[model samples]
Target: MGEERRGISRRGLIGGGAALGVGAAAVGFGAGRATAVETERAGAAAAYSLYGAHQPGIVTPVQDRLHFATFDVTTDSRAALVDMLRAWTDAAARMMHGDGAGPSGPTSGDYDAPPDDTGEAIDLPPSRLTLTFGFGASLFDDRFGLSGKRPAALDPLPHFPGDNLRPERSEGDLCVQACADDPQVAVHAIRNLARIGFGTVGMRWSQLGFGKTSTTTRDEATPRNLFGFKDGTMNVKSDDRDALADHVWVGEDADQPWMAGGSYLVARRITMTIETWDRQSLREQERVVGRTKSEGAPLSGGVERDQPDFERAGREGKPLVDPAAHVRIAHPDHNGGVQMLRRGYNFVDGSSDIGRMDAGLFFLAYVVDPATHFVPVQMRLATLDDMQEYVQHTGSGLFAIPPGVRRGEYVGQGLFSA
Candidate 1:
């Protein structure tokens, strides 16, 4: 094989610097044996991670998945918050594309960069670390945060068919986001973030997004909800990095300070409607998924991977995943798969009469490559998915996330340069 898909490309990979660098880049710590480099930054504290495989991955037993959660912190003062965020990120000088050898540049912050075999402290590799800065809707009105409309690309596109959630624009104080699946990897990245004054973090609430029902695990062949039809039948798998790159990633050349690192961005929205779905019956509901509602087997049957028997349900020779059924609408060809990485949470917006309340999945997906992975999935649903009848995407927006700076740097460094 030319190279393992998971291996980092060496084209721009610089090597050889100092073995003692601390806080260099986050480590891909999957289990025990800490690959830690001590430093003055963020002192020391116990850290924990909740890593699970939703997709395939580099973690042992290799599966594609990501750690999903949301958190926040109130700064003693806005100025103090900004300064803290900046210093945490800019601790090291990121590797430029043209550098002959990857070596530790001058130490600039409270922590030292971690060293690769070359002893060089490198920047977080692309997709290795991602930051998305989203503002609270109210924060935009003030002078401190992004004002008015967001940039063109920092917006959410439809992830599922039958569009209900759409984006609305207004600036707000930003949410500091980061990603790395290994609990240690995630914790390391997070600790570096706190080293700057921005460390006082709190999660108002957060969870992986999908529907309220079904945990959405791979163990089940149906992959749909209790209704038995294929659900989330259209989603991104581990191999989709290239497919979503254009839409979700900030692909800068190595020349940019953070080239190998990802550019920060956002896609956020409020997803609603599980109650309407509950009212349907097993038989009627089966019609929507184009399969039997009891076993979650294809309408035609014969295990999940085998071609589902669509011909039995309709007049023409289509699989039971009816052209109009959510699955049929979402996966018309049977062979085609929709692409989207679903990481969302459930929340309460407010209430209505009868003691009823407004609450549902608050959805978000960061795309480094959108054209292939994100768009096609949404396009298919807009045209065919049966699942659309009960749900609607409600409110949404996009934001560009800046890359991590060496510990002492501010979060806005890349944004200003971009």
Candidate 2:
């Protein structure tokens, strides 16, 4: 029931500003325009939010992990809304309260059973695991009764590959994404997904919000989708301000103690198979991610975050991307360390009883150390990359987002009661 704490803080919009809000009102918010009147006002303004590197906790909040709650459940009684979504995908104190484990169940730090009204139990709010899910509209649509009536296929977000949009717009009506490792259990799991109805029932409306990032590993394309090459060409390029503080802010002297007004640490996961990935051959999926099925570039070129030159694409030492590629294990450089920061989102949900599912990405990032920046590029994509054989990390979590809570305080004030 505690909704108005407004927004901002994936380390202050990764240091510049696009999503995360109290309505910053830039509306076409930078990216893809150095100018031409900011590319004719970024086309006209609006369309960048597919959720940019989310965070429900900046870097402190966990009894254990995996906390993401996105909803909008309305059940005048579609048989109590499909038994509340099959008791929210097969219950156990609604996933995680019983400590969810996997078989599609098991991951719960306990969060004080029966819809945590700030109960803080069930454990989770540390580095990050599975709870990854995505669904949009069509609760069988008849508005909500589930039969043969379609109207909830809502998803119009597509324009985040170094975006330069603007043809005139400014959206908001539906968008719910919450990631948590503990910013008070990411606001008690988005207010227990709006008290079990799934969230914002009657609608006070306004959803559009993205977040912090940094990714490249877990394969099948960045651990199951949400922008790990959904046209990946080395993302996050704030152009200047140190690439806008490395894709949007978080360095005022990052030492840690829970860093106060936090910034960094926002890992993610979501892999649903993507048209069974059309079983390879786009040149074996561009030689398992070295780049280019007509432009993801790199095999040592000046695209996708450039600087690539891997001794000019292997320098005849036999490497035009294949020493376990995924862009040479996510940029090995041969010199200048590795780098990350790619805010994200891209999802798909299928009507259940086990029918359609097509999935991938809602992933995120923002770092300082996930063991020297996201576990050595996800331990070379889970041991010797190759897009880790068509991907599968399946939903996970970790949040610690606490920064921007001034107007009389309360948005994890002191990172959720310390």
Give the candidate number with the greatest TM-score: 1
Compared with the true structure, what per-residue lDDT tens digits does model 1 show for residues 1-418? 2222222222234232232233444433332311122122221111111121111111111111132333344643556556644543343112111111223322321233432212122332212332333434333334444343333344444455455543232123455433332333333333444333234444433223233222223443434432335443334332344544433344655233332334333344434455666678876677776656545556666654454654565556554566566555545354244333444434455566755445554444555444444567556665666666665566544434443333334555443333
> What lDDT tens digits, residue by residue, belong to model 2 across residues 314-417?
54677566677666766635313645555554445444465645454545555443445555566556677666555555443333332333323322223223
Candidate 2's C-alpha runs over 4 A off are: 1-177, 181-188, 196-246, 250-273, 276-278, 281-283, 291-307, 310-340, 343-356, 363-403, 406-408, 411-418
Model 1 scores what on Cα lDDT?
0.39
Q: How many residue pairs clash in each candidate?
A: 69, 64
Instruction: State every prediction's TM-score relative to the real structure.
Output: 0.49, 0.33
Kindly provide the TM-score of model 2 when superposed on the true structure, using C-alpha atoms: 0.33
| CA deviation > 4 Å runs, candidate 1 | 1-84, 87-152, 155-173, 176-234, 239-248, 253-271, 290-319, 332-338, 347-351, 355-357, 369-386, 402-412
lDDT of each: 0.39, 0.37
